[model samples]
Target: MNQSSSQSSNRSLPDSEYYRAFLDRDSNYDGIFFAGVRSTGIFCRPTCSARKPKLENCEFFATAQDALLAGYRPCKRCHPTDHPGSTSPLIKELITLVESDLTRRWKDQDLRARGIDPTTARRQFKSRFGMTFVAYARARRMGEGLKTIRSGERVIDAQIDSGYESGSGFRDAFSKMMGSPPSGNVAHTLKAEWIDTPLGPMIALADESALHLLEFVDRPGLETEILRLRQKHGLAILPGRTPITELLESELASYFRGQLQEFTTPLHLYGSDFQKSVLKILQQIPYGETWTYAQQSEALGNPKAIRAVARANGMNQIPILIPCHRVIGSDGKLTGYSGGLARKEWLLDLEKRRKS
Candidate 1:
């Protein structure tokens, strides 16, 4: 943080150390520079492009916010700012640069022509975003593609418009995402991960940073909800798993086995605004007690949203962590969950057992 450290930090690290970290997706450097992968047309933090980068091609930057300000975008999984790079003055510049030209593909040659050292750009990006520029760019494109899909555009169109060459190529890109085929192939969609828990094996999903869903298979309404998610996201579930899901397995297992009371891991909550509002209230419910929908609605300041609140509970993507099971009916009956009624009962009883 001193002047010499600042000056040295402005210079790029040797490719050996710089690109290696990008390939590794090391989280310790999330606020570092961004890497833009040429092959994928995405930019990432130094911690991204997990597949590795060649010595000749790796670009370095001192900040992801800078690389992004240089017109690069964020890698989905290697989220730089949501982790803390936002604390820098450079992050604001990156936001403007990328948002201004999201459609333009970034290239190292382009940087060099502009008097920017692409390799040094990698160091800067790695220093901030935790990856090189190209890695971040590719992730940004994928994100736009998902948004396009969510907006009711066709996947093929989303792909072509986003800079990919074909639907197969798009599918391959998505495989790197939610770990599933396109939702059109529901039976084969790999939208979530299933893990063993002390209470029972549970299924969970995420795009990268967010926890999409976490529930017991036997829980009521889970199947239908999964199908709904498929149609909504135009994505299928892939067989891949993320560290968050692994953590979810361990934490929920401990919670159900009656050994833990709090969950601090990150959660991916995807839904409507109402659902999000309901989730915020649910997260505040005490671990040992429960709240009726009437109580929850009252807390949210919308007495009429009680049923809406229940619907949001059913729509919750991160269950136990969000603690939707804590919401009850006016009659004190455990309400609906994408997970089964029986599992809800089991979880409630399990929490009680732990409290006792």
Candidate 2:
């Protein structure tokens, strides 16, 4: 809880040891010390990939904020402020339970049974996954069920295997999500893969052709979009790896880490011609800039279609890759973003930071 190293004696190991760890790119020294390079005016994790600076130019700080306070910008390459491995032990325990029993419907009572406070569990899970623990468990179960169905199990059997109690409820839910009954054809299945990011968890929908949906797991109407995709494409959603899914996972990891600006994944976007045009224009909004709806409409040669442009932006299924968040209001304020305006702000701030 000490704010400054000067206030806390014996804060870090010897500076000489930290320098040696930086030279060797030892991850063990990651959060222990931040390396501020006087020459580059940037602070980095000890394990940063950027070339090491001269010892005289390198100043070690106990925390990232300390380096920033000393007028050092965060290294875009290293992202010293983030530590993805710092998930709480309690969350780890809960995740294990969810993975072990994909058929079980986890609830607040379940956390209480495990000696965990429901409120604490929900807050931590929401912070890490951008969804409640119960929602994460539901996604896990759906992913498992999709896998079971894709393995040639009968629809009703797959429903039971997925932990559904009533056949009618299962069929209704399956129809809502899949846009059709569980089919015998394995080729009709679309892959549903979960990708984790610093922002939150994202669910990627893809097939052999291209990625259809890439949205944050907590986004409202996500289930509806999944159903729409199924009905439009006549495909069932399942949990598995596809070439597109694998490539997207890699690309998304890079994108979230500030390593990549542009996404090259092919997309199977379904929409009216106007909608497709709007999204295509969105992709051209550049990496670190935003455009207003009026501007986007003007770019489409229909300056009067400002509202239409905004509506099309809202209908975009693929969010980040399509860059709908880059579209703002004419007043230069952030408007509606399906992933929440906070996330919109975060994405913009992240891009601006990387640009700096």
Candidate 3:
């Protein structure tokens, strides 16, 4: 199966695609990839069949041995460590050192000081995890921050415990996931997390009020949208979870599984009244059905607002749930979408297939 080389980090499965497979426990991908759950600190084959972990808690590795090398223990049920290759003694020792000093930032020079070839370590880690060892270590540190916060520790305490000396760095990192400032006493703040999908990874932001944003990783102007939402709503977006996040994750998994046709997750919309009206028109777009910009404009009682309708569609931060992709050109040609035209096509095709 020449699995090792082919499954290198660059050639690894896309997070979104692999996440769908993992959710389904697809046996075809069993030997091709392993999933590491940050919350449990365990790795499992794709077909593990255990209760699926939250999307934010997952990291993918190309091999079971790599999972072990990255400091995750193999799942007892999946027996990922029982796979073909054995972890080299050197790699095992390296992993041990990494786990022991997870709070300390690691550098290639540190490996060299220990008589290990820095290039070898970098290549091995990159091949397996699609990132350099230093990157993996930093992610581990961030994971620690998540744990501290999840355990009910205050944000400031978690920042120090996660080895951050600067308050701004900790706040920035934490806000991007948790969607609330370390000192925020704000209520109903949406927590944002990334989930891998077949097209690519998508970000989901939610709070007790409603699901706020769901945009693809490659969506154009995504950062702009995030910033605007944060500033306008005074919400801090970080990498944590809430009850709504769990609900959205489950609904999204079912959406991909073809078991869910519509989303019932509550949503917190942010925009001008006109934009809200435009989004409302978009939401009325039925499953497997599409509307043209002109059609939408007329429906909104402003037939002359065709261009405005199109602009609103482009500005939509929420994609599938709002059904922005269902708005096409008057000529029935697919038009501009923040998630890209190709995704628009795929979403339409998926709806069509499921409709039959």
Candidate 4:
């Protein structure tokens, strides 16, 4: 088939605009499009380091799946299917350091001692993890302290071991995170962890029984959602992992690789009865297929509840497992997705390609 015939039907922008982005190797367009070279039958990300092709030989696609289905092999030089705007080497190195020593509180001086710039670290960490490196380190330390206290160690000892010298400082930080002083009889806690995917870093929250929340770190209003969860459940969210979170992380890895179609991780959904019903129908959307809001409302036996159905989808705290991205507008155009329209498009394309 010719390049045009094989191109994705969902291309939102003109070919000229995509070509300009490709020529510039713009990181902003990295996940937005793939340039398929007719001459080489190879496709690459917009920020691919490989040499650009002539305009006449190029066709643009909305997603990696689109390019692959269009009969273009992924360019080995860029590994378009592997990494989008490949995670920075600095981010990888710093994360390695933290994982090796979770309880070690990282300070600006410690970063400088390692010849790393504190300002750059903060900016990069904020961009990637949605928090400063120091904040992330502190959360790790607090999580460690929580574990120590749960292990029956004295609260004071846990504080000292966590690198806090002043008693008030330790309690203040601990209380702020756990919603209660370390010495209080805090019986239940929800552990949260950052799970990295090809798309981006996502925050997963869970207790012992079920996964509560999983969302992209960069999603708007994410902080407010977390706060609401904390308030609603009366649980302190610490940076750690539980059985449910670990299961979710593994399932997510497999799902992204297109090896798993259905999610088995248990979930504890929090919502109104109508919202809960709406989410249940969303799960039945069938992998690789989509349903319009009208279809969803009809399924609910209330054809006039389209707006309500859309609102319920917007309020979905756990996205992928609940399959909120499968819903679209009646016009066949994508609707509002809290994870961003690009992600919605990419996810739909993934499911469509894998299903076939």
**Strongest candidate by lDDT:** 4
What is the TM-score (0 to 1) of candidate 1? 0.45
lDDT of 3 at 211: 84
Please give the TM-score that candidate 4 achieves against the real structure. 0.54
Pairs of residues at least 3 apart in sequence or in different chains that clash in candidate 4 = none
| Candidate 2 segments whose C-alpha is farther than 4 A from its true place | 1-176, 179-188
lDDT of 3 by residue, 1-356 (tens): 00121223233556778788889988888667888887676888888879998777787766554454333555767655333243445555665675665556678789999999989877776664465666556554444433433334566676675455764544445554355563555434666565545555466777766888887644545555776777766776554577877787778768867778889888877778999999999999888888888889988999999988888877887788888988888788988877667878988998989988
After superposing candidate 1 on the true structure, give the runs of residues whose Cα lies further than 4 Å from its correct spot: 1-191, 219-224, 234-236
Candidate 1 Cα deviation (angstroms), residue 221: 5.1
lDDT of 2 by residue, 109-197 (tens): 87788799999988887775356677666654444333332333455675675455664444444444554544775347776665655
lDDT of each: 0.59, 0.70, 0.67, 0.72
Q: What is the C-alpha RMSD of each candidate to the true structure, in Å?
A: 19.6, 14.0, 10.3, 14.9
Error of 4 at 310 (Å): 0.7
Order the candidates by lDDT, highest first. 4, 2, 3, 1
| Per-residue lDDT of model 4, residues 1-356, tens digit only | 00132244356688889989999988898767889886665788888888888888887876654453333555767766445545677766775686465446678999999999999999986765356777655544443433332323444565675455664544444444345532244445777665656565466778899998888755656656766776676667665667887789889889989999999999888899999999999988999999999999999999999999999999999999999999988899998998789989999999999999
Best by TM-score: 3
Clashing pairs in 2: none
The lDDT of model 3 is 0.67
Which has the better lDDT: candidate 1, or candidate 2?
2
Higher-scoring candidate on lDDT, 3 or 4: 4
- In the range 54-141, model 1's lDDT, one tens digit per residue, is 6554455565433432223555565555445344434434444555544445788866776767787666666654655655554343
TM-score of each: 0.45, 0.56, 0.56, 0.54
